[model samples]
Target: MKIDLSFKIAVLLVPIILFDTLAYAGIIPEKKRIIFKGDEQQQVLLIANTNDYPILMQTWIDNGNTQNVPSATVSPFIITPPMSSLAAGEIKGLRIIYNKQKTLPNDKESAFWINLYEVPPTSKENKLVDNVTVAMNTQIKLFYRPTPLANKPEEKTLVTQLSCYGKAHNLEITVSCKNPTPYYISLSNIELNLNNHTYHNETQLDMMVPPFSDNSYRINVDSTNVPQQVNVEYSFVDDKGDVHGVKSTIRID
Candidate 1:
C-alpha cells in the first residue's frame, strides 16, 4: 500500500535510533543479506509482515551508515516505493534499482547496508497523551558483485585458501586468519583448543573478514608459551548465509 505524503514526511522526521537490543520485528526480511550482481539492473527483496497489526516500512540504501535517513543517505541504488504499508500476514516485495550515474569499484565486491524502518500504527486517542512508541530499524548487508567476479571460485572453494595461526605475547594469545581470496568471509563459533583447554575469541561472535585481509582475535592464556599445534574449529557463512563448520590444525609462532 502507498503511504500518504504527510505520513511519509512524518517518518522522515522521526529520529532514527540504532538500538542494541533486538526486538521482535513485525516485518521480516526473507534473506540475511542481498547479493546484487552487476549484470542485473534491479533486484527484488521479499518482506513479510507477521504481526496481527499493520505496519509501515520505509527502506533505503546507505553506505554502511545506520544513522542516515532516507532523505540524507546517498547510495547508488534506489528502492522502489521507498515507503509502503503492509497489512497483517501480508508479503510485499521491494525492488532495488541501481543508478548507473555512480561508479563503484569493479575489481572487488563493495558492501552497503539496506535499512528497513518499521513504524507501527499510532492511536489517535493516545496522540496527546505521553506514551513511548518504539520503532525498529533493521539493517542487512548488501554486496555489489561485479560481473567479472562471477566466474571466480565460490566462497566454499576459497575457504581452503584461508590460513589460521596463533601468536603469544605475554599472558595473551592472538589467533589470526589470513583471507587471501576475493570473497568476504563471515565466521562464527571460533574456538581454539590447546592442551584440552578451549579458548573463545574476545571479538564479536559473527565476524566478517574483508577480502584479502587478516582479522585477529585475542584470548587470555595462563602461560606465555605458544603451542606448536593448535586445533581450530570455526564456522564460515557462504554467499547464501549458510554456515559450514571447519576443523583444521593451525601453527603457533
Candidate 2:
C-alpha cells in the first residue's frame, strides 16, 4: 500500500514539475499579427499577447526573401502598460514604422516578418532565463504606376523640374511645374527612399497655375538621422483626372 501511494504521488508531481519548468523557462504561449491601412503611405502595427505573463519583445522586418538582408528594422516606438506584471488575459500593442525607400527589390512585391521575443525572468543572484520568440508574416506590395484621374475637363500639357540637396542627416527637395494648359493639377502618391529605406505621406497638393503659367512646390527631408542614399517618387493628376508618376535618385557621401 505504501509503495503504491508513493508511486502515484511521483507521477502526479512529474507533470506539474514539467509544466512549471516550461513556464519558468519563458515557454509561455504567445501570438502576433500585422495590420495596415490603405493609403499612399507605408506603415504597419504589430499586435501581440503573452497569455498572462510579462514579456520583453524585439521586432525586425524580414522582407520574405532569402537574400539574407532584412528590408527594415523596427525601433520600438511604443510599449503600452509599461509595467513588469502583464496580468493574465492582457493584450499589448507595438507600433512599427518602415521607410519604403530603404527596402530592396524596389517596384516589386516583397514579404516581411515581425519577430516577437518573450524575455525570461532573472534572479538578483545568478538570475538567467532562456528566451523564446514568435513571428508574423505579411505581404508588402509596391505600386509603381499612378492611379487614373477622375472628372475630365480640358486637355493640357505641363513641364516640371525637381532639385535636391543632401546633408549628413537630412535632405531638401524642390519641385517646379510649368503649366502651359488651361487647368490646374494635383500631386499625390509621394514616396521617398534613403539608404534602401522608404518613407511616404498621404497628403496631396492642389497646384494652381493661371492659364499658360507655372507653379512650384518644395519638400524637406528632415529624417531623424542622415542616410547613405536618397530617392524620391511622386504622381500628379490633371484637371481631367489623368494621373502620371515621376521617380528620381540621389547618392550621399
Candidate 3:
C-alpha cells in the first residue's frame, strides 16, 4: 500500500486545524459568573485547564476606576494530581474578589466589563509552540445600590428628573404630556436643545385628565452619539395645545 505524501500531510493537519479554530473561537468548555457575598463585595470566577498546556487568563475590572488591575487578592482555585499533568477537559477555578474599598469610588453605583483575555500557553522561555491550550473567559458586571435611609416618596405624582450622568452619547429629547383636568387636552409639538443644537418633533394627544385625577406622558432623551455636556432643553405642548418647554441639565464626568 502506497500513500501520497501530500495526502498524508493533509490528513494529519485536519484535526490540528480544527482544534486550533475551536480554541480561537472560545468554544472550549468553561464557566464564568459574578458571585455576590453581601452588599459590598463580589467575586469573578474563571476555570480552565493548566496542565501540559498552560492557559493564561487575564482578569480586570471593566467599569470602575480600578480597571486593568491584575487578579491579586483573587486567586485561581485549582485541583491537580500530585505529579500528573492537567489533561484536556480537566477543570480549574480562578476567582477574583472585588472589595468596595478598592473597586468603587465615592457615589459610584455599578460596575461592568467588556471581556477577559486568555493568553496562549507558552514555554518557560516565553516561546510560542504548537500547544493545545484553550482560551475561555467572560466579563462580570457587579452593581451596588445602597439602601436608602429615609422613607421613599409616593409615585402618584411621579416627578422624574432626567439628566446625563456620565459622558453623554447620542442625545435627543422627548416630553410626555399629562392632563389632570376634566376636559380633553391636545399637545402640538416638542423641542429639545443641547449645546445650541436643536431637536424638535411634533405630536398630538387626544386624552382627558379626569377631575381630581391626572394623566401622564413620557419624554425620551437619546444621547448615544452626542458630545458630553451639562445642559439639555425640552419643549412641548400643554393641554391647551399651547407651546411650553423646560430646561434640564446634568453634570457628566
TM-scores for candidates 1 onward, in order: 0.80, 0.28, 0.31
The per-model lDDT (C-alpha) reads: 0.76, 0.39, 0.36
Per-prediction RMSD in angstroms? Answer: 7.5, 20.1, 18.3
Give the true-structure RMSD of model 2: 20.1
Task: Give lDDT tens digits, candidate 2, residues 211-245.
Answer: 34555444556555655556766566543334677
- After superposition, the stretches of candidate 1 with alpha carbons farther than 4 Å from their true spots are 1-23, 125-130, 203-206, 220-226
Candidate 3: list runs displaced more than 4 Å: 1-46, 49-53, 64-87, 102-108, 123-138, 147-253
Error of 3 at 66 (Å): 13
Best by lDDT: 1
Better of 1 and 3 by TM-score: 1
Positional deviation of 227 in candidate 3, in angstroms? 25
Report the C-alpha lDDT of model 3 over 1-253, residue by residue, as the tens digit.
2334554454344346534322343313232223233243333332334223544545444542333444332322211111222344344334444444444322322324424555554565544554564444444333332333112232122222321233323343333334332222222233445445565543433222322334433334554554545454434333222345455653443
